[model samples]
Structures are given as structure tokens and as C-alpha cells.
Target: MAEGGEDPQRLKKIAAAAYDYDNDSRWTDYWSNILIPPHMASHAEVVEHYKRKFYQRYMDPDLVVEPMSSTSSSQSARPSASTTNANEQQARSRSSGSVPRTAGPSATTGAANPSSVRWDQQTIQFSVNAWVFVIAVLAVLPLVPKNLSNRAYRLSFMGTACSSLYSLYALYGRPRAWNMQGMQVYFQSIVGAKDFIYFIYCLTFVTSNLCLKFALIPILCRALEQVAKFLRRNFTRSTIYRKYLEDPCVWVESNTTTLNILSSQAEIAIGFLLIISLLSWQRNFIQTFMYWQLLKLMYQAPVTAGYHQSNWSKIGRTVNPMIQRYAPFLNTPVTAVQRWWFR
Candidate 1:
């Protein structure tokens, strides 16, 4: 120790010498040839001594040490040398290819760094416009009317067509050198939200189609039947009615019973459509809740499946009985209106 209980200069010299020796030996065979090789044979003995000392200090059982045989060590060097040569040859072969060199953090420092150019305002604006168009199309598709009120529905469909065309153009016309990561980032920036939005849109679209086909069509059919009945009773005279009544097949075909059967079938179709829509709504609600539950579980810990299973079991028991009771009605002839009229 020097003045103030410090040996500053001495410590600095020792550190510098150690650092220099490490760097030199790492690049050369200095330590391996002069120091390590001589002590390599006694490595197990040194390790055993340290292990025994550690165990004694801790009052633990002594660790067993197994020494490597000299013959094994000598034989290992031959394979190691052969592997090194093979690796060097492989490296040379790889270097002959046209793969681009990547700059690491250290390589990018100082004069090795390259300049980056920012995108122009026009390019940024175009990208923003493209993304806006994609989002608008996906969001509006489900809301478009089946019964066209104006030119808006047609316009919306055209917009979707145009956007799809643009997407195809962008996919095929882009530069081939663009890497997958860059393309993915580009797509995420532009229309990644559409993936989720489109799912909802498709559900709504299918539901709307079903409403048009089943509910609206059935109601329209019922209205047409009523109109036909009114026109037949009012416009036709007694003579025409008597002539039609003489043909029993014609009377049976146009009778109230036949109309009631048609209406009943229509009602069934509507019922089926409503049931499907109800199931879809329920699934959406359950999935939304499940997704939130999953997020909570991720942040905290796992939740038990018992609650979900119990609720579903209760629902199944309730629905199953109703379904079984109604199973007979599904095939039973709808005769209420006929029986009432006949009575």
C-alpha cells in the first residue's frame, strides 16, 4: 500500500498487463503451448482438490472426480484437427456463393455506416390512402343492403372489386428482391386489421343472406297467397267459381289447406334461419368472453375449466329435453288451420 492506503499505479499496470496477455494469447498459441499443455494431465487432480475443499467448507459429502486417460486425449486431437480443416473448406465453399453480407452492430460503427433516406411525403400519403381504402371496404361490406335503395350498393361492390384488384397488382408488380419480413411489415401496416374485421363482416353477410332467403322470402310468399285468395274470390263470378269447383283437383290445389301448408313450410324455414342466427350470436359472445379470459389468464395465472363446463352442461341439459320433446313435432303434419276450418 502507498499513500492513503492505495497502490493506484501498480493496480493499473497489473490490469493493463493482464488485458494485453489475454488478447495476445487469444490470437496466438502462447498460453496453450507454454502453460495449459503442461497442466492438462493434472487437470483432474486440481479439480478434485477444489471440489473437496468446497465440500469440507459446506460440511457436505465429497464429490467423485474421474480423470481422462492420456490415450483418449491424444486420440481426440486427431478428430478435432480433421473437423477444423473440414469447417474451413465448408466456409470457403459458402463464400463462393452470391449471398449478401450483413453488417453487425460493431461493423456499422464510424465510417462503415451507410446513410438512410426518408420516404417522400407523396409516398407516405399514398400508403395512408391505400390503407384507408382497405379498411373502409372491409368495414362496409356487411352493412350494404340486399335490396338496393340507390347506386350506393353497386358503388360499394365496385370499390371492393377495385381494392382486390389493387392488392393483386401490388403483390405481383412489387420488386422481387423485397424480403419476406419487409413484405409482412408492409401488409401489417396496410391491411392487417382487415383480417379480424373481415371475419365479422362475413358473419354478418351470411346472416343477412339467410334473412333475405328464409325470412323475407317466406313472408313474401304468404303475402302473395293472401293476394291470390282475395283476387280469386272477388274478381271471379259464380259461374266461373262453379266451373272451377267442378274440377276437384283444381279446388284442392287452390284451397286454404294448400296455402296453409305452404305458409307452414315458410314458417319452418324462417324458424331454422332464426335458430342459426341465434347460435351465431351466442358463439360470438362466448368467443369474445373467452378471448378476454385468455388475456387475463396470460397476465395472471390459469383459470379452471370447471366454470365453463358447468355452465355448458346446464345449457345442454335444458336444451336437450326441449329438443327431444319437439322431435315429434318436426315430422308431424301441420293440421291446425285445416282442422279448425273443417270444424
Candidate 2:
């Protein structure tokens, strides 16, 4: 009747009655708060216990007198229900040292976790983003000497490319089908994904000869956003994060749109900078061509197209008038590029 002191059948019914999984807001609330740590969410018994409590509060106050009182309850020998509040029971269990706990390494004691840090993809991504931010900052800081700054910039690109690749792999595993049609579908899906675009964006500059400081803006903004998200999710209880990092994290989340727009602007400006470099001896034609292709993909990809299309329109509006007025000869090529862009 009960596996690990919780009745599977009863919990399943309770969860079904309590939750409208199709309701976006309700499901989000249940998953984020009721679920607590993610590991417990997978267990039907734990989920049902919470759902029963949720049902009692909202749907029917007296539908089930004691939800946990089942055949397995007798097997586990838990005492009769003294409270309907699941959270209160958990709190009491913790205080009385009846509840078991599992955690990764302690920040202070350096204790080993049964499931070590390597198993947590979130933590790995967080560390990678944090490093990317630090490296990007070092590259941007005026105090850093030119040689070291250039090296740091290249390292930042390398780190971002690695992080993006890992994220793609973790999100979408390798394709099962390897044939022509199957591979075509898989490639299209990957190309449409936001992570794949970011990977390519970082790869474009990995071996570039130019050290344009403006190029790091997008990498820094993206790293800050990801690092802030990880901190908010995992370090909400930490005193250090609460005192110092919380406000910045909150601000970053609140202004994500602003950050994205800034990154888009920088990217567009960098394209012009590359064109200017073409007039000098430091131009890499291959890098410029590849970067332009990447930008074209960004403009077409659903996830990034909104921001990029708007930026490109603004640039066209401003540049088209100037070209038509003083550079009439460039009008034909500009029209050709516009046609290609729309196509």
C-alpha cells in the first residue's frame, strides 16, 4: 500500500484531484514552492502528500479526514494525524531529528555529498558562467595591461563557447536517428535553439586577431544573467548572498530586457567596427564573414530575431537616408542586401 511510508495509489488520486497540471500559474506555484528541492518532486508519494494538503485548503475542507492514514501508515507506524499542515509536520520532524537530510559539500566544513557536485549540472553551469564573467571583466578593465587584457578576452570567448556547448548537450541529448532525414530534422532543431546560436556567436571570435573591447559586452551581460539566476535559485538561504548578492540578482532579473537590448546594440556596433578594421591592416576577412553569417542566423532564429530585427530596422532607417543623400552609388548594393535580409 505504501512505499517508504506513503501510499502510492492514494497519493496519485489526491494529486489528480488537487492539481490542474494544465493551468500554467497553478502548476508553476506547485512546482516551485510545494516541490521544494527538485529531488523530491519525482516521488509520487511526496507529491501526493503535498497535493492532499493543497486540496484540503482550496477544494474541500473535509473531503478526506486523514489523507496519510493508509495501510502503509500502519506499516510505517506513524502516529495519528495531529495536524493538517504538511509544512508544520515537516518542521516538527526536522526539530525532532526524525527527517533525513542530504546536501552537497558544506561551505564551512567541506563535507562530502553522496551525490557529489559533478552530478549537479546547474552548479557546473553556474561555476562556468561565474568564471566567464570574471574573465570578461578582467579583459574590459582599463587597469589590465593590453597584452593580458587581450588574452583574457580570448579566454572569455573560449569559456562561453564551452558553457554554451555543455548547455546544449544537457538540454537536448544526441539524436537517436542517424540517417539523412533524421539528421536533417536534428540539425534544424539544433539550429533553431538559442543555445546553439550562442555557441556559434562565441566560436566566431575565438581565434580572431582583433581585440575589440566592445565584443565582450554580450558575453559579460549573458554571464551575469546566468550567474544571477543560479545564485537566486541555490543560494537564497545563504547569508552572504542575501546580504550582498540578492539586490544585484533581483535587479538583473528585473532588467533582463534592458540587458538584451544593450547586447544587441553592441553586436550591431561590433559589425561596423569590423568593417572599419577592414580599412586597416588588422582585418580577418574570414572572421568578419563568419560573424556576419552568425548575425544573419540570429536575425532569423525565433528566440533572438525579435531583438535583432528591431535593431537592424533602426540601423537601416538611419543609414539608408545618409546613403541615398551623399552615397547614391551605394544604393544598389544596399537594396540587394536588404532583399537578401528579408528573404
Candidate 3:
């Protein structure tokens, strides 16, 4: 009814549509277009929370917002908090938290949505598959006879070695963008003999090519040294810095982004604790477990979460046929070996 205050229903309409992390509503765009604040925005904190959601979800930090023509109510609309605790905590975040920076239009081509649960989960899955494949290859290589004349032997060796190196880098995590200061911060966070043990565990399998009586001593010491160095790096810090928390395009959890980083670390630990051989009963067991896990994880990718999108039908149509075709190829070797040995 007034000069600038818009109808509550109009404000509700603008806010009701789900925000897509990839194609989002802009911070200033909201300021310009949606003049009516939602009735549920009870206080300044609620308004601040809404501001955080918009700026982080849509706008880039460097792109400054052009000044909007002021209206009767300047604050943006806010959604109702789902519960009392969230509302109270939000108040705290408003008071203590440094809200994410807002930019208007010329920020970098909108960066990747770093905090989207779906995005992070997908990335984690990819990283897991990558390193797991490498680990499997490395585990299987030791089983085959070491005959230089056998072309398969040489190819598998070289391939396994290269994959091993890449796995080390994957364990190292994001090295290029992470700096020395961050590394140092991470190092400082390491506490106790368990951390030292975990680091040593990583070293044992890394140097599996060596088969000396005391080889483990040097490897253990070196593992400790490298992990000590790794601890110093800040790239592993867990919490989203308060100032940067508002930016939806930025990562919230340092470790959770790609792969079950802790599990990957633990995988190296298990590799060190026991020697893996394809002939052993353990191999069959573990292989069976891995296959099930891979299939389960693969299927999960297509399951849409609340705000996440996926094309499960399309994915299944493509992968299902490939699985059926390859199933016999994988089983043929075991079947042949069984018949030959028994007969």
C-alpha cells in the first residue's frame, strides 16, 4: 500500500522457489526486485541470516553491488527458522559471525558451489574411486609372478607404480592452492602417538617394492617425518573461517570436501598393518566387500537428496549394460583356475 513496501504474498513468491546453487538469485538483485520483507523476519539477525544465504549462494565476493534505490523497508526478506534452537543460534551467528562479503555484478564467472552437500558428496565419491582403484591395482600386482619376459608383468608393474605415486599425492590433498602457513597450522594440530602411528602406517605400503629385514624401520621413521611435515600445513583445518562462512561458493569443511579423507588415511593404515595377496582367503573376502561397496556407492549417486539433483535412470541405463557385459570377463579367470586345479 505504501510507496515501497511490497505485498507479503509477492515477497513470499520470490522466496518460495528453491535456490539452485549453480544458477542462484543475486544479493543486489534481491535488493532491487523484492521490496517486501517476509513477515517471519522477526529481527536484525534474521535479516542478516537471509543476507548471508543470498550473498553466499549467488553473488561473488569481488563483484560489488551497485547501489539500489532505497525503499520504505531496506532489509531483505527472511525465512522462518524451523525451530527455537536454530533461531537462538542464528542470533549468536549474527552477533559474533562476520557475514560473507557481497558483490554486485562483475565477480569472476560464478565459481563452483563449494558448500553444496551434493557437490561435496560427489567429489568425495570420485576421489574414493580413484585412490581405491589405485590401491586395488597395487595390491593385485604383487600377486603375479615377477617375470621380466612376461609383458603383462612389466606393464602392470609400471602402471601400479605410477598409480601408487598418484595415491600419495591424493593423500597429500590440495597441495597447489594450500600454502606453507596452512601446512604449518595443520602440523601444529597433530596430537599424540596415534597420529605418529597413522603417519607410519602410510609409509610402510608406500615403499612396498623394498623387501629388506630392517626396511620398515627407515620407512616408519620417514613416514613419521613426512606426516610431521604434513601436519604443519593449514590446508587440513576443519572449520569454515567465520569471515568466509557466508560464501556458499567456498568450502566449509577442509577434510570433508573430497574423499572420506580420514578413511583414505585409515586405508593406508590397514595396508601397512597387513600384507595383501591375491591368493590369500583375505583377498577374496576383501574383493567381495569392495565390489559391494562400489556398487552401493555407485547406485547412491543417482538417489536425489532434498535439494540435490541427479539423473538415476540415465545413469543406470548406461552403466547396467556395461556391468552385464563385463561380468563374465571378470568371472572367467576364477572359473578356469578352479576347474584346472581340481581336475
Which model scores highest in lDDT?
2
lDDT of 2 by residue, 188-296 (tens): 6578677788788888888777888898999999999999978887799999999999999989977888899998888888888898899899988988888877788
lDDT of 3 by residue, 1-343 (tens): 1126666444433443333433432334333332333553454544554554444323222122222223323344222222322343333233223342333243241122222533454344344333433433433455545442233323333333343344332322222225898556433322122223323333433434332222233222222232322332322363642244323212212322122332333333333333344455434444334433332333233211111113334444765577568775655665564455234
List TM-score per model, in order: 0.20, 0.65, 0.23
Between 1 and 3, whose TM-score is larger? 3
The reply for model 2, stretches above 4 Å from the true place, is: 1-119, 178-182
Stretches of candidate 1 off by over 4 Å are: 1-145, 149-210, 237-253, 281-343
Q: Write the per-residue lDDT of candidate 1 for residues 225-282, one digit (tens) a residue.
A: 3334433434466676557643442343346444444533443343334445556644
**Where does candidate 1 clash, by residue pair?**
none
| Model 1 residue 291 distance off true place after TM-score fit, in angstroms | 30
Ranking by TM-score: 2, 3, 1
True-structure RMSD, every candidate: 31.8, 13.2, 19.0
Measured by TM-score, the strongest candidate is 2
Candidate 1 vs 2: which has more TM-score: 2
Query: Residue 226 lDDT in model 1?
Result: 32
